[model samples]
Target chain A: MRDQPTGDQLLATARDLLREDVLPTLSGSQRHNALMIANAMSIAMRQLQSGDEPERRELAALGKILPLPESHGLALQQALTEANRALCRLIREGRADSGQTRDQVRALLLETTRQRVAISNPKYLG
Target chain B: MMEETLRQALAAFIAKETGAAEARISEAKLLTGGAVQENWKVQVDITGGAYAGVLDAVIRTDSASGGVAVSHNRAEEYALLKAAFAAGVTVPEPLWLCADKAVIGRPFFVMLCIAGTAAGHLLVKDARYGGDRVQLAERLGMELARIHSIRPPRPDLAFLEWYEEAPALHSVGRFRRYLDSHAIPHPALEWGLRWLERNAPPRGDIVLSHRDFRTGNYMVDENGLTGILDWEFAGWSDPLEDIGWFCAKCWRFGAKGREAGGIGEREDFYRGYEKISGRRLDRQLVHYWEVMAHAAWAIIAIQQAERHVSGEETSLMLALTGHIAPELEYEILTMTEPV
Candidate 1:
């Protein structure tokens, strides 16, 4: 649906320009700022490349434990946020402390957190 | 003219405080790397007084937005520094505190400027500083022991509220309350808090814990540590809390191999601490608090991100700090989960 230079591609190019071309010329705090900008651009590019898969997967995982409505009229992000809130409530209530439920919760948290790390800083995962 | 005015004001204040006939402050320059506070370096020349000598000192004041919710104010921090200094901890000598706002438009304190690099990444990587990592780690442990020697039930630190619950539980409750106030839910962090609450060890002797006693909070010259810095987050808690925080994997930066603040082995640091404290540490509790360390850092990272996200303060560093939450969450999960 988009043009040749896609969102991810655009971000990747911008990051390259700042990290490789412009960063060498800068110094001190300016260099630090440029590096941070480059890091943000990289993260944005990864998020775009990964798309909504991480969110959808997380929601599907959350739906397993909670009685999520089949036809709840909400956008994906909103639904995901609500599902996470429910999960947090379950954790606080100590409902996720048992055998099977604890395992399920742990798995979901690990996968979702890993996905976020993939976008934020994959080096940490490695 | 503004610089001249500040110089004159500072010189006058120093003269009055130190009983110097003449005091001149020169090369008053602001230092970097304190997100919540401003540190200004100044050279003071004193004449005809007991303190008649050239001195390098640091003037610390709140930034425009002040500090975090849990930290001490300037006056309290000055008192804490003096206490720590008296306790024989390797801290900067607290010289004077100016509470009068008219002096610098905000409350500020001055301490003897310590010489060393407090940069975390550089300290971990550059062998120039941490070449003799064993000695450095041991010295750090000894310094921490000195800090832990200062107990509570004192008039000077009466402002610090004595928690009814165990210190670990108290911290978990605090973090949970903060999360409740936020717009979004942190399920990962909630899980961490739940785990921490469920498995918290029994209450130990509540000594003064350097809450932020991590690699980045201290300084290191080539010879070794010059002085411990950033007592803003210091408080009364379990002694193991500081040790756990020192060895936490998150605090190790990228040098994960060297567990003690990415500087040396945990054995050496613990050995130094045990030598001075004369108490054996529960190694299991240290692990639990290491997990808690990540949780606490996650909460702090969230708050830092909120400062940017809420449009209160726009800083790239703060935003980036928030991005670190996922890694912290992953760490919490790894540490809490069974092998």
Candidate 2:
């Protein structure tokens, strides 16, 4: 059997197909749909290129800041998740009023969300 | 015949005293920009009710579910509309409010349909109407100032529970609450939230704030602004919030150079607001809230996109709304980053 294309090769092929073949044929709503799909695909491609290292780095950063017990992988994830949930709860209760309090919570939350940016696709940062 | 429903409701509620039955209802279509609420074009032909002629009206209702965190109920919206129309704010005249779910599957209200264009791009692009753009923008600013001057104290209007000492801080919290409710992760939006929290403007005098004050939210005629629609986000807050929101880049209708809804400069808008209210414009406060305005909108864009992805309400419009986040993020970065 022929060897399968690598992930990068597959993404390159998709990008080529979108620019050369798909986009030229699309019109009206179809054109809009094609552009949107292309955008999502480009983001997915970028995430693959970076691997999950960004997530791991962010998790390690979270482990340093938050109050998590010293287990490495899953514990870090759980701590990050708990921090996000706690912040969300505070926001829901409308308690994030003080500037310093809001700043601390937002810093923690931003760090957590930044780590997960790979899942949301980097091209979305455009 | 439930043909008498409109007639009877109007007679009992509106005091129009019509005994006619609606022979037919037609021309029904959904109006855009009411994600938390809905408006449907409702045309009725009355045969024997107290009213005898065909009438064009809009049926406003709660959405399948409330999409926004702080949307007022249908009855509350109707009351606010009636109060504003009575205060001469140029709104469609509210006719009747039906809280019963039997008639329309949800709480719904009816209002007289006013004829005017509400599309911002069409207003800016069509040369026939384009000449009136700057003048209309100024007039809109003046009219908004007039709206701000209205100080009704009815119980229905006094429901907002903003923090007494620090309204600006409370506003930031409310926006954060809205974002948290959706639970979608956005690094850029989180950054915006953090920026706004760190740079919160000091609270100023409170006024009746139309939370969504912008070009697409208003109706325009050949002369000027005819009415401001979408009062579901109305509440008591710092008036500069409305001013900053009106001048935000997101509402510029594709004309990035024109700050005032892509129709005029900031000077013209400020002059109109000041002339009408007799209050000097605070440039610094306006600029600060303008940043907050974009932050709030960024969260809203995320929520809209999430609605489509979550299978809550799937539509091309919702999907396009999600695309606006990139531009919003760029605005936030430029506004709050260290100089």
Candidate 3:
């Protein structure tokens, strides 16, 4: 088991300190840099909190769209990349132009992008 | 901004180029915010020549680190600036181009500097600069119309590629090709691309487009616009492409309520364009290009982040740029969602 004050906790604490303390002391590009660092830390914390659950969910979602051998052994990240890449081909081929497929693809893309935004910048989701 | 040897070479080159007894660089300060280009603000004093006075200029050259494949080199950018200047576009006057790399270790050009700030975030909020927002928007529109006046078939700009596909479709194809080569898939971006393909504006009057036209790309003083800048991405494309790029929500810099580049209403900008081009803008067509603009920005963001991800450059800014893609993707998704 991981110890207390894990990676996310550390990042959260650091980001709070940077935003509250360091940012006020900085100006110009230094201020911009501090804000960007704080933003990166927040993103890291969000990703850590969410863990690999988003990727796992993404993989399962991709499995529904792309045809593949049942239970074909592949790692989570690799399988996700492969499946999403295939979907890219399908979309480009106009297979998702207008129909159930188009609607499903749109929904999937929206959901997946929302998931990414959830980690990268949740405020954008508004 | 310049080493001793480079400064000496530049002085010699200026002296020779202007038929001056001597040219001395009083100051050379590297300006910020051009990721691909190095822009050095240079102040020069010339003696015994037609240009025999203190002059302010910008020395522009490619960063040795290289840039996107689609952008033109320093020489091409210089030529584009000349064309824009000739077209009466409010651009920094292109003074001279030096193709000899041995002089500065890279091809560089000199242009008369315009006084203003070009930071989008500042321009949007700070009334201290950029003058009256409505007039600025109108002027920007007029400037864009003037830029679009420079049509193809010119011998000098023969370097620009002539494309058969509608500009929108061409852009979508380019993005797809990039995604195909990218290490990972971007289904959100692809979704935007598909919508663009379905609704691309038809191939129409081809004109020179300031492909990177946006709030940050131009400069404005307390009174008004000083000049349009950044022509590295200049190319032949449908005129609406530039308009879309200019008015895209992504370019608004958080001043979403204002529209027309976060400065004025859309009609004011369009009216300015109409005053110059004597043509009306099709709102529907402009919307399509706005969607394309988001997709284009997302691609550029991904490429920048890749520069950091692949270790070609270690930069916090580049890594942060990667994070912006999701926001852009969200914008794309919202814009392309069926009514």
Better of 1 and 2 by DockQ: 1
List of clashing residue pairs for candidate 1: none
The sequence of per-residue lDDT tens digits that candidate 3 reaches over residues B1-339 is 578898899889988989999999999998853557888899999997878999899988877766667789988999999999999999999998999888888888999989988999998888788888788889999999999999878999989988888888888888999888899898888878988888877899999999998999999888999999888889999999999988998888889988898878999999999999999999988988899899999999999999899998789889989999998998898998768
Ranking by DockQ: 1, 3, 2
lDDT of 1 by residue, B217-259 (tens): 8987888888888888888898888888899999997999999
Considering chain A alone, what is the TM-score of candidate 1? 0.94
Residues B22-92 of candidate 2: C-alpha lDDT, one tens digit per residue? 44564556674356776767666767765567878887777767656667888888988987787667788
The per-model DockQ list reads 0.89, 0.13, 0.81
Ranking by lDDT: 3, 1, 2
- TM values, all candidates: 0.97, 0.74, 0.96
lDDT per prediction?
A: 0.88, 0.69, 0.88
Model 2 misplaced regions, further than 4 Å: A1-42, A45-71, A74-126, B1-23, B30-38, B47-52, B66-69, B120-131, B177-202, B221-224, B305-330
Between prediction 2 and prediction 3, the one with superior lDDT is 3
- Docking level for model 1: high
Predict model 2's lDDT versus the native: 0.69
